[model samples]
Target: MSEQNLSSLTNIPSTEVAHENYLLAKLILEIQQTPDEYLPNLLQIVRLFRESVTMKPVSSDAWVKAMDGIKNPHPVKKAVQQIALSELLRKWEEDGDEEEQTETAEILCQNLEENPVSI
Candidate 1:
């Protein structure tokens, strides 16, 4: 699939974010069956989830629910999530829209405060 299509898939409607979580779970199962084909798409979906979480255009709960579908072990999952969030924040700081930059910074601060990561 084209990068445009992959990006579009990540942009789930806010109202349908719950449905996206279900879809993500199914995708995870599919990836296990066809890793070579599905892995890239799965990573794209995860990037979209990270964008959703950082951008805060959708419910944070929905983003968290979508992340729950990642099949990695607990520590790895946590680390990956943290890394995604950090990278998004860094990217936003560098080049995001001014309004979104402020909003994302606030959300990132709140998340960090609420869920401190252990090294």
Candidate 2:
């Protein structure tokens, strides 16, 4: 990741997955602004999902399913992405930080209509 990309990532660290996905959509839209990359974005998405399990602490089966979703980038990818994005949105709504709320809504409104999560 270039300095620009790192700066971009640092600029927003969502407490939940929907906001992460929303921010990621924004990142994709302006991808040309950063270095051409691969796993950084994907990795970030997966990382966001993983963090959700930590935040929620569900059953072992659920945890495994979540991990499995990203561990292999196959049929579960879309589902996992949606789950993560859903979490992000939930957190955004519950978040008390005014800065976070505005940021999350702005990102979500900007991308949700187009992205649709495919799942």
Candidate 3:
């Protein structure tokens, strides 16, 4: 939509984003499963979502999706859900051998020390 059209439309204040935690994940899944021929407007939707979040950062699980999009989004919402999934796999890298776990634990300890508890 044009800037004029966006300005003319009813506005949604930053304090009131109408999306759930996993909404982005769901949307990405749909976009990925959906054939490319049906996604002429996907880029517009993604841009809108990016703007909404930028206006007011929400505690959203879709941050992963955002990161994936940044790293490598499909050609105008063709299907970057796989990218998000690939990023998500980094979480499992921690479940590894003894040396890796110990190194990870050390890093976590150092981070905790750097940012001590504030209770």
Against the true structure, what is each candidate's TM-score? Answer: 0.31, 0.30, 0.23
Candidate 3, run of 10 with poorest lDDT:
6-15
What tens digits encode model 1's per-residue C-alpha lDDT throughout 1-119?
A: 45455446556564656776647655655565665877788789889998888884758897787776554347877788879978977887788799987887789789979986455
Q: Write the per-residue lDDT of candidate 2 for residues 31-119, one digit (tens) a residue.
A: 64556586598669768988887796579999899887656557666677768978987886786588978886788788978765443
Supply candidate 1's per-residue lDDT for 108.
Answer: 73
Name the runs in model 3 displaced over 4 angstroms: 1-25, 56-119
Tens digits of per-residue lDDT for model 3, 1-119: 34444433324453354455235444555576678976878777778988888895645678887877666656645445545644654664645677776787699789979976322
Pairs that collide in candidate 2 are 16-88, 17-88, 18-85, 18-88
Q: Quantify all predictions' global Cα lDDT against the true fold.
A: 0.70, 0.69, 0.60
Residue 33 alpha-carbon offset, candidate 1, angstroms? 44
- The true-versus-predicted C-alpha distance at residue 10 of model 2, in Å, is 29
Q: Give the distance in Å from residue 87's predicted Cα in candidate 2 to where it truly belongs.
A: 1.7
Candidates 1 and 3, the one with greater lDDT:
1
